[model samples]
Target: MGAAEWMQARSPEQSLTARIVRWYSFLSATLVGG
Candidate 1:
């Protein structure tokens, strides 16, 4: 399954954790790539 489908299968706690990690990754990329 694709990412959206995969994420939908996760529990709410897992979803929240994934969201936090996604934000962290975005920030890190911006900081390092800027």
Candidate 2:
């Protein structure tokens, strides 16, 4: 899927709190891995 469509699809799958937690964890892992 395209970036815009993927983001649109994901937005409603989780609450704001859940999304934030997921994004934070992803960023942390990326930084650590890099």
Candidate 3:
């Protein structure tokens, strides 16, 4: 399956982890960009 399909198949914990990672990356990028 493709990355999008794989992401859709992920479990709840994996989704939560993904959200945390996204937030962490966003925050890190904002800090560094500023």
- The number of the candidate with the highest lDDT is 1
- Candidate 1 lDDT by residue in tens digits, 1-34: 4764466477456786786787689889999999
lDDT of 1 at 6: 63
Question: Against the true structure, candidate 2 has what lDDT?
Answer: 0.69
For model 1, the run of ten residues with the poorest summed lDDT: 3-12
Clashing pairs in 2: none
lDDT of 3 by residue, 1-34 (tens): 3644455477555776786776688889999999
Q: What is the descending TM-score order?
A: 2, 3, 1
The candidate, 2 or 3, that scores higher on lDDT is 3
Error of 2 at 26 (Å): 0.1
- What local lDDT score does residue 13 receive in model 1, on the 0 to 100 scale? 60
Candidate 2 lDDT by residue in tens digits, 1-34:
4644554467766656566777688889999999
lDDT of each: 0.73, 0.69, 0.70
Weakest ten-residue segment in model 3 by summed lDDT: 1-10
TM-score of 2: 0.58
Q: Please name the candidate that would achieve the greatest TM-score relative to the true structure.
A: 2
lDDT of 1: 0.73
Taking all chains together, the TM-score of candidate 3 against the true structure is 0.54
After superposition of all CA atoms, the RMSD between model 3 and the true structure is 5.0
Candidate 3 — which pairs collide? none
